[model samples]
Every structure is written in structure tokens, then in C-alpha cells.
Target chain A: MATGEVKVLGSWSSPYVMRARIALHIKSVNYKFIEEKLSEGKSELLLKSNPVYKKIPVLIHGDKPVNESLIIIQYIDDTWPSAPSILPSDPYERAVARFWAAYLDEKWFPSVTSVGIADEEEAKKAGISQMEEGLALMEEAFGKCSKGKGFFGGDEIGFLDIAFGSFLGWLRVTEKINGIGLIDEAKTPALVSWAERFCSHAAVKDVMPDFDKLTEFGKMLFPKIRALAGTR
Target chain B: MATGEVKVLGSWSSPYVMRARIALHIKSVNYKFIEEKLSEGKSELLLKSNPVYKKIPVLIHGDKPVNESLIIIQYIDDTWPSAPSILPSDPYERAVARFWAAYLDEKWFPSVTSVGIADEEEAKKAGISQMEEGLALMEEAFGKCSKGKGFFGGDEIGFLDIAFGSFLGWLRVTEKINGIGLIDEAKTPALVSWAERFCSHAAVKDVMPDFDKLTEFGKMLFPKIRALAGTR
Candidate 1:
């Protein structure tokens, strides 16, 4: 019944927003993209769509606004079942897929982002350590999901891949801005290789933001975030 | 293929653990229960099963363990599809259910717990205000989901009910212990009535912990949690 057409309320730099785009691409969902100046304040449309959080990456399907990236991605998958299924068809496998996505959202992403906003050396160090722990867990998770396959989610790109893969560029750029050498091949070979595979994928390559452009954006914003987070 | 057994690694007094129990009961899935002394640092079985987070309410099915309560409930629905579905068959409705569950996890649950953990009166007040905000949203969400029906899920208890309903007792006990009134009829009539309906249901009643014992547990744990959270 999507008479009004599909639209995504998002900004370029957010990994969460990237998820909505990635799912759309994989599902071949043609959605109108609306950018929001996230730092200034949420737009009226964004607020109206997602009044609870007032955050970006709201997927407007016809008149209904679906907030939260994971939920939105699943919505995309559910809405368009014929398109390359993001999650596995098997029940247990689907649960495994969801579990990792939640882990990435709760652990991997936040810890990595913490490195940028935390002003103090100790806090940044803690964040780095936490990120390393999360990465280690993801490395293990990838092994289980792949089990001698190309992607973390078997041969083709799947939900977990989209979940973590969407953030590789932003995570890398943020790490450089924070002046940390996390996610290097030497330290985390498995994850680094996984990132490479992810970037090479047409689904990711077509949609991901340019690294240099993202880095430039990070330079402007990371400092402000650091200030807001306050020095220890 | 569940030759081993269905088991829940959990302890009473946890809304998360309650969710697993409630979901199992609602689905009428017969499962063994393993009581974990979470405060004493997770047991080896619990650790091995759920290494990433190592938290409780892990639903073990035939040796495969599903962590995270929401994921577990969905897993139950998926594994036992013959039973009542926790989520709707319709993709859009399913997405809506997930959105609200995420909202409860991210907004409602945390803000309510914030009241317990926060030390200062100002912080607690802020937590209450946020919880109020979350409840108001849930009120609107219920209206949308119900559409002149009984449950937020309409006609039957479903995912959102399990998500928030599982915590009603814990929330009420915590509120009493903290000496703050949150879910009063005047403030959150819709939610209040929903709780009454949820508790009265055979599926929820059969599995939920005894109220008097749970209240005693909350009284003891609240102060300890407050101290750990660094409050007076």
C-alpha cells in the first residue's frame, strides 16, 4: 500500500543511517533520501516521523514512520521478501543474525564511537580497550557465521554483515581523528580482512560514503563531540 | 532436532529472565529451568553458553543458546511456529512490534531503572520525567496497535506485551522501594490497565514469580544497586 512511496530520513555520516541505505540497496528498495542537520536539531519531519527518539534514519513507508535502524532494516527485509533476504530463513540462524546485530549496536559501535568523544587519555584508552574486546568478540562471531565462507554471514552479504560493515569507513575515519591505530591488519587481521571484503562488495561500495569526505566531516565534528563529552 | 532439551538459564526477580519464562509459557513450550546465581558471577554453563555478554535469561535449545530476552522470545516464536506467534505475520505489523520493543528497551526500561540507580534527587527527578515521556509514547503506541482492542498487540498478548509486561512487577516493586509513584492510573491509565490485563492472563500468571517474594527481593536489591551505582 506504499502509495506515498518509500523515504529515508537520514544523514551521511551516521552508521545507523548507512544501515537503512544498505538494506534498501540489497532489497532494491527505491527510497527518497532526506538529509537532516543532526547536530543543529531534528527537523519537523524527522520529529513527526520519530517523535520518541527524534533521531535520524526514520524509514517512512507510505504514511507509517519506522524508527531505529535495526528495526528499519528488518522492515526492509520483511517488506520485500523476494529480494536477497538480509536474515536467514532458518529460525535459529535468524536468531543468531539478530543476536550479533544487537551486539554490534550495543558493543562494537558504541565503544568505537566512544574513542572519538572521550576527551581524556584514560577514557579514550578504556574505550579503545572496550572496542578491542568487542572486535575480538566479533572476530569470533564472524568465524561462527562464516565457517569457511567469504563473508561473516556466509557466501553472500547478509544482516550481520550489513550491521557491522556499514560502519567500517566511519569507524576508520573516527579512529584516525582520535589518533588511534585500532582495526589495523596487524592487530586484528580477521576483522581487517572482513572489512576489505565488505568494501569490495557491490552492495556496500555503491552506497558507502567516500572515506576522505567522511574523514573531513569527522575532523569538524569529533572535536565538538569531545568538548561536549568533557575532559576527565 | 531438539534431542537435548529446551532450558532457560535464569534467576527470578529479573524482568529479562521473566521474559524468557513468560515467552516459553505463552508458547506452551515445555522447557527445563536452570537457576543461575547471577550476583555471584555467572556459572560456568551460563558463561560457556553466553560468552559475549554472559548475562542471564539465555534460552538453550538443543545445545544452541540464544541470549538477549527479546531475541529469545522471537526465537521461541520462530522455533515453535505452531504456538501463538509473538510477532505478527504481516511484515509491517511485525516491524511495528519490533520498533516498540526497541523503544521499551532503549527508552522505557532504562529510564525507569535510572530512577533506582541515580543518586541525586535532581537525577532521579530527571529519570522520572524521562520515564513519563516514555510512558506517554507507549500510550500513543498502544492506541495505534490496539485500535479499540484489548492488548497493545490486539486480541492476544504478543511481543510488546511480553517486552514491557514482563517488567511490570519489577517496575512496581522498584518504584515502591524507591518511594516514587510512576505507573499510577491517573498518569498512565492505558499502561496501568494493560498491566492488569497482562497479569490476569493465564500465560503470564502461570510463569510470573510470586509478588510478595519479588517485592522482598526488590527491597533488598534496590539499596544494593543504588550503592553500586554510587548513590546514598
Candidate 2:
């Protein structure tokens, strides 16, 4: 079901780019992939396409360019109506899916990332607790969104799954490199299960970086984030 | 047309809540209003409705509840489909509107608000320049969204107008209190004109709090935000 011109400018380390990759893969859309050299600064294509942010995970559908991973995923869903629905067709359900996705970005994602790099012992503790709280909220959201189904959109993998799964690699890396147990089976059992299911999903398996490489990246990147974020 | 049941839990002075009000008013949907006083802590209804965030601007349609200002507005758009289109009907256009709305919330909104409350001259200067950059991005977005029309939704006031207009009162108050010129006539003619047109729109005009009262709120509230946000 190739509709011609679909291209994604992505950076391997960015979870956001991973998100766009998984979404496009799920829709079974054929497209081109352009690897961006992040250390060398934004590519000309990236600079021209997403001049505002000049950031990756810019999905180009034909002549138009859509930036932002979540928005791009939705664009893929809307454009490819015949493909499996990334979001539920019901308006209210769709809104619920969107709200949780935004919640993950706002409340959960940052907390998870912060725990991976927090310098001070006290701040790391605080970040852990904050992440726990974020997970609890996510647990509640999953109960509501899934309604006793396999995935957030019922029996199929959907938007929320993709959004949350984007972070699975990073989450594992955080646990490994930081020597912290983030997704404790005791506290966030549902989320832990969801993480296992999501990482092993068919479409997701291809794009996710190898665990060893990701862990190496995490070890290198996290201390830099800690240095930059500062204790003050 | 009257809905079976509708309710809004809001704060009198919250720009986010105001976004909900303007959206509801534009939809011409009949609904109940309940103002939550934050200083006194969360209302039982608010806590019950939105246990996760425990924030206001929760719109209840029948028994179902939707939280987050942007999400609520989109809910209003979807539920009250007969009313004026809150967003462009085209999928691509809708994605563009969503992207800019998120940009305003993420980039522009904070910069606009911070300038009003930044305690140090350096911080204030930084905020002012950051806001200038954000506004520049917005100016570009308006060019694409409006295409020489009155609002971001073309001839009529639409989603982006409501998104930006949510901050109109705060923008005016910031300009008046901070003594900083954000939207100069020569610099952002389109935004300046849009602000004027939005403030006067009938649905928006009725709900926007008085200038004097909002300015007073800014005076009392800003120092507190600076303290809570921390000087670091």
C-alpha cells in the first residue's frame, strides 16, 4: 500500500524518531529513511523541512512535511485510512488516547528521563518517587484505555502503545546503567507487563536499537545530561 | 442546540480555563459552570472528575469527563460537530493546527508568562528575548494558517485563534505591567491584528476577564511563581 513519497529524517538515539518509525511500520507504509548526523548539526533537508525546530522525526508525506512525532503519527493514520487505525475511530475514545499520550510526554517521560541522569543521591531519589507517581497515573490510564483488552486500543497495538513503547529502550537503559529498578514488578506490574509486550511486538522489533548499543549510549549520554541539568 | 448534559469546572482567572469557555461559547453548547478555587484546595467534584491531574477545565459531557484545555476544546469540537468548526476539517490542516497549538502551549505560553514574573533583570531579559523568538515562530505559523484572512482558521475565528486568545488577557496584562513591548506594530503585524480581532469577537469578548482585575492578579501572582519556580 505504497502511496509514494513518504520519508522520515531520524536520529538513532532519539526516542521520538523511534516513535515515527514504529508508527510508519505499523501502517505498513513504504517510505525512505534518512539518517541524520546529529553531532554535525542539522542536515540541509532537516533545516529546510523543519526550520522552526530543525529537529529530527520530521515525516514528509509527498510535498508536505509534518514535525513532532505524535502529530506525524496521526498524520500517517489520517492519510492511510485503509491501514489499521492508530487511534480509535470514536471521538471520545480518540480524545482519551490523545490525553494519555500527552500525559506520558508531559508527566511521565521527563520523570523517567530525569531519574536516569539525576546527579545527587537526594535528587535521584526524588526522581525515582516522581517516576513512580507518574507510573501509577499511567497504570490508571491504561486500565481505562484498555478496558480489559490486550492493548490500549483493545486487541490491537495502537497510539498509546507506540507512544509508551518509544521509551522502552531508554527505560531499560536507565535501569541497566543507573543500577536502579524503575519498573518494579511490585509497584507498576501492569506497566512492566506492557513494556515486555511492547518491546517484543513484531513491527517494533525492527527499528529498536540493539540493547548493548543503547546501553553504551545511555552510559555516555546520561552523565552529560546530569552535568547540564545541574543540582542547583 | 442544547446538549443533554454539559459542565465545566474552571478557575475564573486561568487562561487555560478561559480557552474552555471560549470553545464552549463558540460551540453554542449549553453547559453548567463550576469555578474551583485553587487556594482553598481541590473541590470534591474536580478531584472526583480528574483524579490524575486534579486540575480544572474538566468538561463533562453527560457523565464522561475530558481534562486538559486543548483536549477539552477538541472534545467540544468533536461532540458538538454541528457548531462552527473549531479546527480545519482537512486532515493535514488539522494536523498543522494541532502542531501550532502545542507549540504555543510549549514554547510561547511559558515565555510570555515568565516575562511577567521573572524576578531578576537578567532572567527578565532572557525571557523577553525567548518570548521574542517564540513570537517570531508564531508569526510564521500565522502566515501558513491564515493566508491573509482574519483568523488562523481563515475568515472566522478558529482553533489557533482560541489557542492564542486564551492568553490575550495575560498578554495585555504582561505588556502593561512588565513595560516590555512584545508585539510591536512593525514586528508582528499579523499577531497584533489577530489579538485585536480575537479580543473583540463576541464569544471571546464575553468571557475575557477585565484588564484591571487581570493586571492586579499578575502583580500578586508573579512574585509567587518566581519563588515557586525557583531562581535557579
Candidate 3:
């Protein structure tokens, strides 16, 4: 049983996890979602599957494990080359899309982590500033990448859109917890609009976790992160 | 009149810049390399070409610009398919290669930057520790990926090897500046051997900048970076 099946080992709350799920859904691929409780020791399967990262969102397709949410999406795109292409056909456009996705993965995610954990008065300020800087870069990059286009790749929701789309769900929670409005109408109207459009897509909407549950989870997790940061 | 010609806008000492150069050389691509003095105001062409990053290693292939060293390499590989393949053809192997390349880009690069700037008292300890950690990870990953093979993929040197190869060049200089030794014969022996084999490759040996000059440049950069960090 489960041989040659597509299995995703992930947690319900991880934004990176959501990315893989969204990609799978968009591509209309059938897969089993195995929710892992990361607080406990990771399962042996998870460890063996992704020994390098030893983290969640490990997409095992036909017995081969692909770690890294963005990479997994690329693997899916490559494996299922059909309608709803997640990346552009043109190499130049593909590079731009990948650059933004990489930017989001590297820059934006760190800020989210900082904000999630920052506690000291000064440290909190630094965290907020970092978050704002990430948002500003995202806004600027999105503006350039989405000139006169609906989606990041124009007329289609590609990998860049899907990659960033996963973060929006978590960002909303982060904004609420931090009491700071990023992606506001004044600050990042285009990004806000894109987030709205992205979340509205049937593929995205169908797999998205309950927002209220996520916010509640964030509320619980934020304090623990802050407490850990204090020890550091 | 260099119409439709390839131009690389980069600084002389940058590892990222060297990545682009190596890719071009390996692919036998004919291009003009424009060295930018980053201390001064960046050149108009560099800024215009990569308006977002406004940094070095902007590869102007024909009429299009590709920023980000890894992205540029991917573009180069795509453009020159018949030449030496940078990435592995197999999907799983390619994903593993991309993962390590990203690990270097996201994790190792930042640690190396911090090492360059940290104060003397803190730098030696923290920098050495960070370097060792990164090296350990690299060694483990490489050992698993290499699987008794000569190179990362097999007999042929591939993308993973090339990406790690560029880092090793800078790492040597950085270690020398910091008065520490990484990739020694005893510790991380596999990686050290890998580095030795990698550096000996015709492609790498031909394109790699002179180590003596790089060391001299590192000596100059270290003080400036330390002074800047002191202020911050």
C-alpha cells in the first residue's frame, strides 16, 4: 500500500507546507497529505526522506523525495507538463519569476521568523523594520514583475505567484499578531490585490487551511518563539 | 559596436561574479567582462541593466539581462544546451544539486559574510565555528550525493560541483584572512579532497582568478568590513 504514490510530509501550520499543497492542487495531482507534528521528533521516514534539511514539506513522488517547497513545485511542474504551467516558457521570464521566488524564500521568510520570535523592545523594533523591508522589496519586485499583467507571469498564475501566495496566508496572521498593517491599500496595493486574486483562484482556495485556525495557532506559537529568543 | 553581444557587469573579487565567469568559460561562451568599482557610484549600465538588485554579476546575454549568479548559470546552461551541462539531467539528481546550491546561496554565504566583518575577539571564535558547521553540512551532503563517485554527479563535473567550486575559492581566502583553516586533510577529508579535485579540473583551473591576488584583496577588504561592523 502507498507504493509509487505522491506523499507530502508536512504540518498544517507551515507556510512552506502550504506552498507544496497549492502547487499539487493547481497541477491537479493526486497526493496524500501526511501531517507531521514537528514538536515531536520527526518520523524516520521524514528523516530518511530529507536528511539534508531534515524538515517538513518533503514531497515524495514515486518513491523519490524532493525537499524544499519551491524545488518541489518545480519538480511538480516538470513532472506534470500540461495546462496550468506554473513557470513561464520563455527563459528570461522564468528567470525573473525564479528570482522573485528565491527573494521571497530567502528574505521574506526570515523576517517572518524574526517577527514571530522578537520580544525585547529594541529587538521587536528591529523585527518590525526587517518585516517592513521585506514587504517593501516584495512590493517593488512585484510591481516590476507584474507590469500591465494580472499575474506574476501575466494571464496565468505561475510558480512565483504560487510561491508568494503561500506566504500571504501566514502574513495576514503575522500582521494581526504584531498589530502592524503590511500590504495595506496605501503601502502595497498591487501586492494586496495580487494576494486577493491569488487566494481567490479555485486551486488555491480549495486547499487553503482555515484562516481562523491558523491565526489561533500563530497566537499560541508566537509566545513560545519569543520565550526561546529570550534564552538566546 | 558590440551589438547583440554578451556583457558581464561584475566586480573582480566577488565569488558570485566568478560563478558567471566560470559558466561562460565552461560553455566556451565569448563575452566581454566589465569590472565595476563598487565603492564608487555604480555604472549607469549596471544600474539600468539590473534596476532591482543594482549589483554585480549581471549577465547581459544578447539583449536580455540575467541577475543573480545561480540564475545566470541556469540561463547559460539553457542557452548553450550542447555545451557542458551545469545541472544534472535526471530530475532527482537535479533537485539535490539545486538544494545544495541554494544552501550555499542562502545559508553559507551569509555566514561567510559575517565572518569577514566580525570583530577580532568575536570573529575568530564565531567565524571559525560557523565555517566548520557549514563545511560539515557540505561534507555530509556531498558524501551522500557523491555516493563514491569522483564528482557530485559522476565522472563529469556538473552544476553542484561548479557551484561549490566557486565558494571554495573565496572560502580559502576568507580562511586565510581570518587566520583559520577549513577543509583540512584530517577534518572534512572528503570535502578537502573534493576541493582539490575540483580546483584541478581544467574548467575551474582555467577560469579561477589568481589566489595570491584574491588573498591580497581579502586582506584589504577585511579591515574595511571590520571597521564598518565596529560602527554598527
Candidate 4:
């Protein structure tokens, strides 16, 4: 049960950070979680561990630090080659999973995040529209990947599941603030169900941030996001 | 030795496509290379294989297709777990390689590409400055990664080597057209040497497109890139 000395440097609300935690939890890897107070300033350790990005969700196994959430998850899978694999065993399936995960981070997540931070109505509308299109594509992907199973990993949570599931908390907050069910049952029914199952899963249930708390956190952060948007 | 029936859908000019080719060559996997005539329009097979991105460098083994250059490289390593591994066997090393690869694609490549396409003097200057800064960082990275060895994989070409090396053809073209050595020996001596070794490596020598031909191709593409830049 003792899988090496693992440590995770993260912030409570970062979906990216949650990915590392969720993967560790699923792998049954005991790790010390160090919460970084990003609003104040990045810690020296975080800065040292990831000098290039200076970001969080850095997984330190022993003395070696692995940055980037998806890469960290892959590391977890590789380092601990056990059942409930984070990535698929088959090369083709693994590639497909990675592709979707990349799509979620690179394309879909941006549009969804923009919807929350955009000050202008036109920009927000555009963000929403794009987000909807991304979700529709994801809906089709889920049907293909899941093959009438409960999760993206088929029976249990896998790479793509954690990739998207980590963002569910923020999505919930987005829904509350925007007064729109972003993952509407009629639109993305499978994802709606998958979100519910993902949140309730043993490894995830405890790790997921409380809905009201995240909403409160979002309220404090939205102003800063809007200000950052203006400068860009 | 004959491996599985493998095929690579690619465009000759793409650095991404070259990553897959280089990895395959290193692995000694016999694969049919099908060039996608981008200007002529994407082939139906290319479009079907990679519906999500609709991009080149989709590796087909048997019937399953793996998209994305880095992912395809990982797939090659996974499917062919022999010596001369493309990715470092150690999990931490693999993560570090993946991080640098992502940085090359997402950050460094864009700045370098912008220098070639930017029409405005100020924009081109900005691109060059940023590209130089990126090269300087990469120079430091090569030192840490290579550890006094010949390449990023330390004596043999590996993931980060291919990750950065795939762009050497484009970099050479960029250098010729811009009239500046972006990877200058004065600025990044280690990279300058690494570039020489990488280009001449047996696996890479034939795979790397001819310099003059690529330069001519760049001249044809630069106008289109500038036009695209105007829209963005």
C-alpha cells in the first residue's frame, strides 16, 4: 500500500490539481497534499519544481517532481502499473483517450472558462456557443469510448474521465452564476449522468470541492479573471 | 523484421509528421508513408482517421489510428517496447520529456513560426526576441537533459531529441529566410552542436526533408501564413 513518498503541490479549486489527486487516489497511492496559496504568491518550492510554468499540481515522487496534470497522471499509471489503470492498456485505446484529454484541455476548457470570465455580452455568448459545440462533440465521443458502460474508462474512471471530471466543480459554479445548466440533461445526457457518477465515486467524492464553497471561491476570483481579460 | 501493417498519414513539410517518422525509424518499424496533399485538399482516409483534428501524422496500425505527433511517438514506444526507447523508461524522465515536448509545440514553435510569418517589422522583431529567449531556455534544458552526452536522450536520440529535432528543417528554413541563426553558437552552443548531430543521425538523415526544397516550400507558404495572421 505504501507506494513511495509522494507529495502533491496544489490549490484547492484547481481542476488541474484535482486530476493529480484523483489519479493518485484511484491508484491507492498515499500522498501528502500541500495547498499552495496562489492568491498570496507562488511558493518557493512550487516555483523551483516548475520554473517554466510556475504553476501547481506538481506531483513529487520522492525527490523527482512531475509537472503538468495529464503527464502526472501518466506517471502515476507508469510508476504504479496496477489494476484500475489510469490509461488504457491497449495502445490504440490509450491514444484515443489521450486525444480526448488534450481536446478537453486545449479546446473545450478554454471556451468554457472564457464564458465565465468574459465581461462583454458578445464574448460571453460566443464562449457559450463554442462550449456547447465542444460539449456536443464530447457527447458523441463518450458514446464511442464508453460502449454503453458507466464511465469513459468503460467500467471505472479512466484518463478521459478524470480529465473532464476534474472540471465538474467549476462547471457547476459556472452553471449557478450564468443560470444555465451547462451540462444539460437534454443536451449531454450521458455526460450529465457520468458527472453524477464521477462525483459520487469513492476516490473522487471526498476529493471534489464542496459546491457552495467553489461558488464562493468563483465569486472572489471572477473579478480578477475579468481584470486579467481586460489587459489581454 | 516485419511489424504490424503500419501507415503514416502526413504532409512532408510538417514537423509534427516528422516526429512520427523519426520515432518509427528509430523503432525500426516498417510503415507506409502516405503524404496528404494539403493544398490539393485532405484525402477522405485522412479526414476519416482524424475527424477531431483533421490534421496529418495519424499513424494507422492494422486499422486503428493514433493522432497527434507526440501521442503517436508514445504509441510507437508502447507498441514496440524494445531497446532504443523513444521515451525514457523511468517515469520521472518520461514526464520531463513530455513537458519539454509540450513546451516546444505550444510555446517555442509558435514564436519561431511567427518570426517567419509576421509582416510588420515590430511583430517580426518581437517574434525573434521571443524565439531567442526560448532557444536560450532550451539550451539550458539540453544541458540538464543530455548530462554531457551527445543528445537529449544522452548519446542516443529519444523523445525530447525528436521533439525538438523535428523542427530543425523548418528552423534551417527560418534561419535562411530571416538571415539570422536562431540557434546561434554564440547564444546556444550546445544546441548548435545538438542540431548538427540530430540532422545527421541515420534515422533522421533521410527522414528530414531536403533543406533547399523546404526553403522553397516555406517561401510558398509564408504568404498564406501572413494572410492568416491578418485575419487573427
Which of the numbered candidates is closest to the native, going by highest TM-score?
Answer: 4
Q: Which of the two candidates, 2 or 4, achieves a greater lDDT against the reference?
A: 4
Docking class of 2: medium
Per residue, candidate 4 scores C-alpha lDDT tens digits across A92-155 of 7788899999999999889878888888899999998988898898889899999999999999
Mark the 10 consecutive residues where model 3 chain B has the least summed lDDT.
B1-10
Rate residue B45 of model 3 by lDDT: 91
lDDT tens digits by residue: candidate 3, B137-232: 888877877888878866777788878888876788877776678888777888888888888887778667788898887778878988877789
For each candidate, the DockQ is 0.66, 0.50, 0.40, 0.57
Poorly placed runs, candidate 2 (over 4 Å): A1-4, A230-232, B1-4, B227-232
Off by over 4 Å in 3: A1-3, A39-41, A112-149, A177-181, A184-189, B1-3, B39-41, B109-126, B143-149, B174-181, B184-193
lDDT per residue for candidate 1 within B1-232, as digits (tens), equals 2336899998877889888888888788788988897667779999899988888889999889898999998888888888477787777788888888887887688887787767788988898888878778788788888777889778898988899888788777767766777777787788888888999898888667787788887667767898876743
Chain A TM-score per candidate? 0.91, 0.93, 0.92, 0.96
Tens-place lDDT per residue, model 1, A93-184, is: 88899998998887777887777777788988998899878777787788888877878778888998999898788778867776777777
**CA deviation > 4 Å runs, candidate 4:** A1-4, B1-4
Q: Arrange candidates by lDDT, descending.
A: 4, 2, 1, 3
Between candidates 1 and 3, the one scoring higher on TM-score is: 1
**Between which residue pairs do clashes occur in model 4?**
none
lDDT of 2 by residue, B1-232 (tens): 2246889999888889988888889888787889888778898989998888888889887778888999888878877788588988777888898888888898888887778777788987888898788888878889988988989999888888888888878888888887777887888988998888898998889788999999998899988887887857
Order the numbered candidates by TM-score, best leading.
4, 1, 2, 3
Give the 10-residue window scoring lowest on summed lDDT in candidate 1 chain A: A223-232
**How well does each candidate superpose onto the true structure, as a TM-score?**
0.93, 0.93, 0.87, 0.94
Interface RMSD of each: 2.0, 4.7, 5.7, 4.6
User: Considering every candidate listed, which one attains the maximal lDDT?
Assistant: 4
- Candidate 2 or 3, higher DockQ? 2
